[model samples]
Target: MQLLEERILKDGIVKPGNVLKVDSFLNHQMDIEFINELGKEFKRRFADAPITKILTIEASGIGIACLVAQYFHVPVVFAKKAQSLNLDGEMFTSKVESFTHKKVYDVILSKKFLGPEDHVLLIDDFLANGCALMGLIDIVNKSRATLEGAGIVIEKGFQEGGKKIRDMGVRLESLAIVDSMTDDSLTFRPNN
Candidate 1:
């Protein structure tokens, strides 16, 4: 986690409106080595949990989830932000509002991917308002799968999303938690 905090300080940019644009290493030009480290850390943290599957939202979450799945040796399932023409038949859908994009997405996952016997680990790039996480949790509930836990790359600690999910009694882990972000500076919560 210290490595991630260093990376955030070195490469993460704080934009206006509390948006920490990590396009330098995380959001855009990804550092594969760093991602692998995160994957390893996630595996270590959730070692006791029976992670049968890894669930994530489309786009940014996919890369981190895929990398993390390697350590878990589990299939990664991502909730698509857009329903494609190839997608049809039964699906579990939830409405999610994106704080970054300022838009609503009908996040969905195919029923075939999740089931009662699986333990789902939800992953995401960022946790701000918790809407996306809640939507994924809803899908897992619909699948009747056991919600194992969640792992995140970065979390906006000033926001309420992470707290809400934790209050729901889910074990959530974020590699780097940003306690505050201004137009030019960023602050991270020290992970004990």
Candidate 2:
């Protein structure tokens, strides 16, 4: 986690509108080694949980989730932002708002991948307003799958997302939680 925080400080860019762009390493153009380190850390954090599968939203979350799945020895299931012809079965659907994109999407996942017998660990690139995570949680509940926890790469601690998720009684693990960020400086939550 320290590695992640240091990387953020060195490479992350602070944009206007409270945006922290980590395109260099965390999300857009990925650092495989660093992502693998994150996967290891996530595994360590949720070591006690019986994680049967890793659930994530498509796009940014897929890469990190796949790496994390390798450590958990589980398959990664991502909710698609757009419905495709290839998908033709009963599906769980939920509406999610993107903090970065500033749009809402109907995320969907096949019912075959998740069920009551399995325990799920949700993974994502970032958590700001909790919309995406909440959508994934909705799908998990619809499928009757056990929600183990969520592993986030970066969490904006100034935002209410973390608190909302925690209030719902879902365990959340974040690699680096930024309590505050500006164009010139960034501060992380103490004891993260």
Candidate 3:
């Protein structure tokens, strides 16, 4: 996690409207080796949990979730932002509002992938207001899967998402929690 904090300090860009652009490394143009390190850390953090599947939202989270799933030796299930023709049968659906896109989407996943017998670990690139994550949690609830925990690469600690998720009794691990952010500077909450 220290490594991730250092990387954020070095490469993370602070934009107006509380956006932290980590596209150059974390999301857009990924550094596989670096992200692989993250996968290892997540495995170590959640080593005790009986994780059967790794769930994540589509787009930015897919790559990270795949990498992390390798360590868990589990399949990665992502919620699609849009309905596709390839999808069939009963599906779990939830509404999520994107903090970055400023829009809402109906995220969907097939029932064949998740069920009451499995334990799920949620993974994502970032957690802002908790909407996207909340949507995923809803789907997990609908599936009746045991929610083990969540592994987030970065969290806006200054925002309400982290507290909200924790308040709900969900085990949330965020590698880098940015407590404060500005155009010229940023501060991270101390992690032990």
Candidate 4:
């Protein structure tokens, strides 16, 4: 996690409207070797959990989830922002509002991939207002699956998402928590 914090300080860009652009290495253009280190850290963090599947939202979270799943040796299931022709059968759905995009989407997941028998670990690139993760949690609840925990690469600690999720009794782990950010500076909450 210290490594991730260092990377953010080195490469992350702070934009107006509370956006921290990590696209250069974390999301848009990825660093697999770096992500693999993150994956190893996640595995170490949740090593005792009986994780059967890693669930994440589509787009940004997918790649990180896939990398993390390799360590867990589990399949990655992502909630699609929209329904598509390739999807079929009964589905669990929830509405999510994107903090960055300023839009709402009805996220959906196939019921066949999740159920009461499996344990799920939610993965994502960032946690802002918690809407996306809330949507995924709704889908998991609908499927009656056990929610093991959530692994987030970066969490905007200045925002309410992390607290809200933790208050709901979910185990949330964030590799780098930016306590505050400005155009010229960024601060991180120390992990202890």
Candidate 5:
């Protein structure tokens, strides 16, 4: 995870509203090598779990999920933020509040992809308010799939999302747990 922490320090930017911009190597302009490392780390952290599938949200989570899916040798299922005509009848839906976009979205996942037979590992690029992960958790619950754990690249430790999920007995693994950030400075939590 040092590679990821270093990347954040070198290229990440901070906004006034507590957003850490990692578009340079994560959501936007991606670094495939670093992404692979993320895959490796996630695999290492959750190695003991029987991960049957990888679940993530669309757009940003796609790339990271794909990379991590390679390590798990499982399929990646992404929840769509917008309702699509391509969607079929059977689906699981939940409302997710976006901290970045400052709005709520009705995220949907096809029922065909998730079921009681699967053990899901949720992955994402960031965790702030726990809303996004909660929406995914809701879908998993509805499908009756066993939740294995969660893999997050960067977590705003100052926020309650990580703590919230952990409190629910979910094994949440965040590569870099950032405590806070200022104009150009960031404070990260020491590894436990």
Candidate 6:
């Protein structure tokens, strides 16, 4: 995770409204090698869990989740932000508020991909207010799938998201946790 922290310091941009834009390597134009490294780290972190499926929300989380799914040797199921005509079966839906987009979306997941037998590992690009993650967890619960854990690429430690999820007794692993970020400086929580 030190590699991720270093990368964030070098390439991540601090925007107003407590936003950290990692579009350069993490999300927009992805660094495949770096993302693969993250996948490996996530696998190592949740080595003991029986992960049958990797669940994520669409847009940013899909790429990271796919790479992580490689390590688990499982298929990735992303909750779509918009309902499409291709999706005909029953769906598990949840309302999620995006911290970055500042809008709420009805995230949908097909029931065929997830069920009571699945042990799901949720993956995401970032965790700030925990709305998106909680929404995914809600979907998992509705499907009766066991939530093995959650893997996050970057977590804003100063935010309540991490604490809230941990309070629910969910195992959450964040590659780089930013404890504080200023206009010119950023502090990371020590990995312990």
User: lDDT tens string, model 3, 1-192?
Assistant: 899988998999988899999999989999999999999999999999999999999899999999999999999999999989998789999999988888989999999999999999999999999999999999999999999999999999999999999999999999999999999999999986
Candidate 4, 1-192: lDDT as tens digits: 789989999999998899999999989999999999999999999999999999999899999999989999999999999988898899999999988888989999998999999999999999999999999999999999999999999999999999999999999999999999999999999896
Candidate 1 clashes between residue pairs 3 or more apart in a chain or in different chains: none
TM-score for every candidate vs. truth? Answer: 0.97, 0.98, 0.98, 0.99, 0.98, 0.98
lDDT of 2: 0.94
Decoy 2 TM-score against native: 0.98
lDDT of 5 by residue, 9-100 (tens): 99999988897899989999999998999999999999999999999998899999999999999999999998999997989999999988
Over 4 Å off, model 1: none
Clashing pairs in 2: none
The alpha-carbon deviation from the true structure for residue 154 of candidate 1, after best TM-score superposition, in angstroms, is 0.8
lDDT of 4 at 146: 99
Model 4 compared with the native: what TM-score? 0.99
Q: Per-residue lDDT tens digits of candidate 1, residues 117-148? A: 99999998899999999999999999999999
Clashes of each: 0, 0, 0, 0, 0, 0
Stretches of candidate 5 off by over 4 Å are: none
User: Which tens-of-lDDT digit does each residue in 65-106 have in candidate 6?
Assistant: 998899999999999998899998899999988888889889
Q: Which residue pairs collide in model 4, if any?
A: none
